[model samples]
Target: MMSDENKVGTYPFVAEPFHVDFMERLTMGVLGNHLLNCAGFHAAERGFGIATLNENHYTWVLSRLAIEMEEMPRAYEKFSVQTWVENVYRLFTDRNFAILNQEGKPIGYARSIWAMISMETRKPADLLTLHGGSITDYVCQKDCPIAKPGRIKVEEQQALDEYKIRYSDIDLNGHVNSVKYIEHILDLFPMEWFRQKTVKRFEVAYVAESYYGDTLSFYRQQISENEFDIEVKKNGQEVVVRSKVIFN
Candidate 1:
């Protein structure tokens, strides 16, 4: 709903080769996630500037993100992307984004949740306080109609694929970057299927740690035309992460 005309300029489109390593691409996905948040803050500042609480107090932090890519963008390819507010609920606000090619076809889309924080205490603040304005007014009718992240019941699936953890997947926080879970999930799909359908909603819970040299087996099954459940296990024994991805 917000416009570049009313705010700062749009994100810069860069043409570069795509990273080949799955883990590296995952990191870029996480970076893209952060970049969209920065864009949202720019929009907020354009409309509300600095929202004063009582004294000097205000900040925004990402609380959660749910996004779906029809296909993962290759390393270093040029792509154009844009983001805007979708809606805000209570203390959480939703942001929507689109990734396009040079020809202007959609490559991927995402929805993320953000929350207001107190600069001093690092605690959450109400949506009414930020005054970023109404999200519905800014929601883009063209791409804003995507379905909500659906819920799926977990069921066991045949073990069909495996991947070994590499040092690059680890982040400074000493854990795999959350987006790596997405890469592992996509690894279960054949290239043909991915080319035909795009992911709709990707939700994950990292259950355990995976170390270098560990082989993780992927288990997955389709629940509908637009949804599936995916899990990664260590050597057929321990579960590392479980996720549900909806496609359209």
Candidate 2:
């Protein structure tokens, strides 16, 4: 286990068979999950994890994430994820992560923004108000190499599929989990695409919340041979999430 005194934590993981796609490479959703898990584990060790925050009637929520990978790891590949807080604001905090191969070289990086929300009102909570002024002092200066994710432009695209929210998709927030959204978007592509192309970069900005029983419409548009845009909406016009995926 990595220590918390340095303000950075490292967690080891293996790309198990379940973590891979049909192509036997790590799936985007699983990679995102591993990054978040690393962040959560570090936060817990530092006394501000979701469990600790729950005691204070607050929980962390992901706002946006951008990930860029040199290449996806294959099944049974061993890797280490290092995560640290890059910056902390009033309502949100920015965290950066590095995915390293067995040789300890970075194969990918990601940046994510998160907010703490009150369990009672479901409103944003101030970091200072929750943990006092000292919490902000424990930040790591290490920066992510990739740029932060921005708002995705939704263009005119045809609906690809309609999916109904299932019980498994909802998280403790009573809405669909963030990673599930990525899974839904990835499902739009056929198995052949996953075998031929590799995801070089993936960005997602969650907009509105989708609840159980609500049907989401998935849309896709090709930006280029290696780039694509995706959007999810509950109705025809109400957007739930927007994302862009770049493949190599």
Candidate 3:
């Protein structure tokens, strides 16, 4: 049996035309989706994926994510993503990912925090107790280049847009998927902003879960000429997610 500590998953993907923006470079949201897909595939192959967790009436939820990049891959560019579990703490697990260009050189990296929650209770489960044995034997010595995403202070701002959760936004957990939150935030920005600036870093903190038919309000604050803060809230009260985008 393969020890969880020794497992590493690598996924190769191409930035198709659809994955790129008007600038023909990969969009931040698409990169987020790819990173998440890599994590899901890695977990599923290790026998601790959604299917196995579902059998136990549990599911994994992303709590926080941060990504930093030197540049975005252009359309039709082939790249590879390597992911591994860094450590499994009491209630949360740390995972890291490396993004390699076609030539296999590091172009970007991401770190994510996740927790296992009961399907019925929707409360976090102690990962150590649930997984049987210690899975942190081979923790990655290297740390993520960027700091973890933190909570954003909501400022007085008018709603930028409104979106009603739909079937496409819901995931297997019966709530809006984490990646969808990034997409919604990106959509609030005009296409011209994407073409004019390149995102150097992106961070998101999942504050709360949202369900289908729920309406979400988007708000934005310009921290600086090249930095912006975004937030999504439910019914103008409960915050669903908060994000920061820094451009170069």
**lDDT, each prediction:** 0.60, 0.87, 0.84
**How do the residues 1-248 of candidate 3 rate in per-residue lDDT, one tens digit apiece?**
55544576789999999989888998878889999998889888777888888999988888889898988889999999888888889889999988889999889999899998998998898887776743554355554576666667759479989999999999876889888888898888788887777888888989898999999999899888888898889978899898888888
Q: What is the TM-score of each predicted model, taking all chains together?
A: 0.58, 0.93, 0.91
Output the TM-score of candidate 2: 0.93
The superposed Cα distance between candidate 1 and the true structure at residue 154, in angstroms, equals 1.1
lDDT by residue for model 1 (66-158), tens: 565555555665566667666767687766677666567776766566676676886777775455444335544446445554444457667
Candidate 3 TM-score, C-alpha based: 0.91
- Candidate 3 at 147: error in angstroms? 2.2
Best by TM-score: 2
What's model 3's lDDT at 55? Answer: 94
- By TM-score, the candidates rank as 2, 3, 1
Give me the overall lDDT of model 2: 0.87
* Deviation (Å) of 202 in candidate 1: 4.9
